[model samples]
Target: MMPETFLSWWQFNNARGKQPDMSNKCPPVLHVPAAGEQAQRLAALSQTFISAFTQQPQFFTRAPGRVNLIGEHVDYCGYAVFPMAVEQDILVAVAINTSGRLNICNVDANFPPYSCDINNYEINKERPVWHNYILSGVRGIQDEGGMQQPFIGINMAVTGNVPPSSGLSSSSALVCASALGMAHSHGLSLSQETLAEICARCERHVGTQGGGMDQAIAFLATKDTAKLIEFNPLQATSVTLPPGATFVVANCLAPMNKAANSYFNCRVMECRLATQVMAKKAGLPWRTFQKLGDLQRALDKTLLQMITLVEDSFEVRPYSKRQVCELLNTTPDELNQVSLSENTRHIQEFKLHDRALHVFSEAHRVWEFKKVCVEGGAYALHTLGRLMQESHKSTQLLYECSHPKLDTLVELSKGLALGARLTGAGWGGCMVALVEEDKVEQYKEHLWKSYYSKEAAAEGRPRNTLLFSSPPGPGACVFVK
Candidate 1:
């Protein structure tokens, strides 16, 4: 089918709009095949759904994974992040069921089938099951007070190309697809912005205190452009990348599950404590501030100014529980109750200096990265590459989130790409490299030979699955027959 003829039978006018447009102002609809490769992908997923459920699905919902190009770990700090939707995505085929229970299946046999009553459901936080991400989205909608009728049941078969625990946001994509499927199954209408915010809050049920960058980009992304995703209203502005540059996402073959461990939450707690301490030092209602970005705004200081303030206020040595309690003028119990997360309450030493310095400096790099992308010049690529390298360094030294494998990959990728940095929440995820379009082949070959080949020779495994290149793709959408 041609692009214009795709999803022509959906009749979107009755729901929201007639078609998807360049401005991305309309609700996400699959009127056109997302680029060339997704056409075959949609067809295969449709067939899989029919075979799995023994019924033709009414429609399909898609949510793409995102790669943070420059910004790292600052989204929860309330700073803007630069990210783009990857072509790899989660696609779900949905069919209405009268059984009053939601049935979910995955094409990958590793994840088993899951089913629960739509009206009565509970998310498991003690041990986060994979399907809880879907449940969280459904619960989010149920918590929203404006629904006219209760949500109906659905039979969903899902397929995804994005690798799990690789820092490409496979979980968030699943949550976004589930939210879209739940809303559509219930005959409910939600704007893209509303859905993004709801899904963002909903993922918190899985026990990660993340900002809205993943869901916002998953819903608001446009083709061929990275988005400058901002919070405190949740807006997305498209950013055209410099020409002849390609983003290559390389996996170190190491997986890090953020929900299962406290490494991710530890950084979050440190940032929160750092914010409150900085606010208390500045005498700006420290109790009201929770994020580093909020403190920056309250102090009316530039990003550089924030860095200076961090140096002046915080010591290089780690702060003990007693020291923090004294600084905040509270007891250890009170500090634990108010400042720390459930997983981080036992942490006695907090790296206030390093975490605060990373947040301020990294936030500054995001703005500079955007400026280079917006105002293209002869040295734009070089300048942008330097910023990315600096970001990786700060994430390594200051945030202390980089794994040994990630550091080795970054070191091996030098001279072949403009810059390489660990993306996502760090601690052994994927690293995104900015490579010239023409040099991507050489870059891949070099990485394969330098890193993957050595590992394969040592362990007797395949080398080809470790790396690939992707472009900015569309966000969440619905495909109707």
Candidate 2:
């Protein structure tokens, strides 16, 4: 019955031309391929699942990794982000088991198999366990009251192509796939928006203060189109790219795990503190404002106005803990208790000014980028490219998240690509570049000789693993036979 219902939903969605509403009753369907590359991939994955678990998979859930085209580090600021799903994604092949336990294995032997009772399990936060991501989704659904019926155990074989810790959103992809798998296994129905919100909140259990761009894109992205993902209401509007434009993603080969360290959370805390400080200076209830966008709304000011306020209210230098407490009119103890995150409470200084500056500037760039995309012309691509370049500069200088290797990549790509920038939380991840369609091969070859080839030769490593040319791909879906 569950398999038939899932297939019926998939057939219904496909019959409707692939555009579905966000109603609560209708479950989101996965891509059902008739005959093509996707069909081949699905067949191969199904075979692997059967070989590993010794049973045919009921259904497969897929969630794509994303690349931020223009908006960087602004999603949590309550600003719109420009991101599109990439070809790389996580695929989970699942079958129900009556054993009342989740038996999970990864196709890559590097990740060990994990097993536990489906209804009772804990996520290990201190260690970077691979299966903990799946557990996060399961726990998310359980907490969201999706387990009204008796818990159904599952056998899952997970596999993915998204590079880990390279800022292409591999972790979020896994979590989204797991959430979808759990929903299907239990015969649960969920809208894309509901699942996106749930997955975003539950991923916090992994200890990364993420802004929901990855999860949103994973759930909402459409084929060959970028999304203007706005927060507060959590809606996505499709933004078509310019004609004959190509985007290339190049990994700097440095992995920055947001959960393993406090850098990502530290930035989040700084932005939160900045908003509170600004609200206090304006004589509003500072504690009520957690995001920079909220403060802007409260003041009814434009992005430029908010930039001015940041310049006027905060100094360029780092603000000491004492200074922040004094500005907010609170004690250090009270500040730690109320304002700071668990990981950032021990830090003594904050870069409030720089963080605020970056948020406001980046938010403005996002709108400008959308405008150029909407009004496509001969120079539209160039204008968008220039905005991306400026965005990278702000992330590098003001936000201080860009790594030296990323900077080197951007600099080296200056002549080859129209514009290049770090696409994620920065600090050693992948950089996305806007290149013309004809120049894509040329750009890749140039990068190979200049960056990948030289680095591989010098370090005695492989060159092909570091770079990729990504086209926009579809969002989350279940693949059925």
- Tens-digit lDDT track of model 1 for 271-326: 99999998888887777889998888888999999999999998898999899888
Per-residue error at 405 for model 1, in Å? 0.9
Measured by lDDT, the strongest candidate is 2
Per-prediction TM-score, please?
A: 0.92, 0.92
- State each model's CA lDDT, in order: 0.85, 0.86
Superposed by TM-score, candidate 1 places the C-alpha of residue 55 at a distance from the truth, in angstroms, of 1.9
RMSD of each: 4.7, 4.2
Worst lDDT 10-window in candidate 1: 2-11
Cα lDDT tens digits, model 2, 1-481, are 5655755665465446533343543345645678976677677777777887777887889999999998888888899999999988898998876677998988788999999999888887778788989999888888883567667678998888888888999999999999988876665667888888899999999988888899999999888899999998899999899998899999998888888888898999999999999999999999888899999999999999999999999989999999999999999998887777788889999999999999999999999999999989889988988998999999999999999989999998988799999988888989999999999888888888888766643266444446777778888887766
